[model samples]
Target: MSRIAILGEYDPTFEPHIATDRAIAHSSAQLGCEVEAEWISTPDCDRSKLATYAGIWVAPGSPYRAMEKLLDVIRYARENQIPCLGTCGGFQHMILEYARNVLGFQEAQSQENDPYASHLFISKLDCSLAGREMQLTFTKGSQIATIYGSLTAVERYYCNFGVNPDYVPQLKSQSLQITGSDSEGEVRVIELPGHPFFIGTLFVPQARSTVELPHPIVTAFLKTVL
Candidate 1:
């Protein structure tokens, strides 16, 4: 049985976290595979411990107990090419991790974590997306487009921050490609070009998943583990 480490401080009150669990279960059954998912608190995560799992799902609900530790896990997965998914707050940290570690922007910081940082790669959205659903247009020929089987998808969001527009050009010039965007062309999903399954979305696809209709991205992420 393959095991997946869900990295986050599990909170019963968080609906997206709950949805993440259900989505994984639904995807597992659909794939005809038994996947054992364990929630690993961010503070207790380390590379050695994380290596035991076949994949990593950095769940929603951020401002984690140990931000550095969480980033360490993300960095480990990215560097080692481990299958990984990050949504909502996890998506924010994914941008931070890539900017600081891969793009050499050591000062890159999430405004939610450090509002006064010199370089705020992740900033508050002009309009909060909490409890809202929106349409996302996938980049043609991108991984997200292939998974969704269409150029457009309707996704859910519970986030208030996203990649700073000022840094979008710089980020796009790097290896990370903005694979999905909104009608206004704002980034909503990103994928690492050569990685096996490294993708992050500002929208929480898990929330829209069900036994009858499992989200394609969640299924795609699990498929990489198999």
Candidate 2:
């Protein structure tokens, strides 16, 4: 049984379990996988690294720093073949990482970057919807296809940044499938099966979770490690 490590913050957004952390602790317990929860802003991470865990789960956070730290860890973990799952801001950083490292775009960056990146991997969103309905369509015969299939999917969003629409066509052309998106067709879920474990979602899939019925993405994420 591989242990699950949750990279989060002391704040509610990252460790928001009704201010109790129950939502998170419970979700991991249901998997029967030992969990090591760490606070991004504080020193709650064991060994100051995530190399010990079988998988990494990056939670939500405000003020990019919280997410910045989380992204750094995700990048490191992915390079090591440790399965990684990033939600919301975590997802944004994952895209940025792929663009910069995998896609060979060193200048790639997000809206949160100091000089700001002008690419589609990360950019300001065009709408003002919160937790609203977002439509997603999976690529045929892709790993995401096996996960959600060709049926259009729906997921909740609380993000204001997304993979630039202009870069969508290019990213898809590079084999980085647009696994899911909003009704307006904004990128939502992205996956690179070529890697051992790499998947990201613009929304917090864990938000609509429960012990009886865990989110397929979350379950699938854990499966990658097992």
TM-scores for all candidates? 0.98, 0.79
- Give per-residue CA lDDT, model 1, range 38-93, as digits (tens): 99999898999976798999998977889889998999999999999999988889
| Candidate 1, poorest ten consecutive residues by summed lDDT | 43-52
Off by over 4 Å in 1: none
* lDDT of candidates 1 onward, in order: 0.91, 0.64
How many clashes does the backbone of model 2 have? Answer: 1
Model 2, 1-226: lDDT tens digits are 4666766554544333232245444555666765554444413544355655777766655335444455557667767777877777777777776777667776677775643545546777667445675667766676666765456666666776777776666676675556766556667778776777678888776666666756666666766766
Taking the candidates one at a time, how many backbone clashes does each contain?
0, 1
Error of 2 at 43 (Å): 8.7
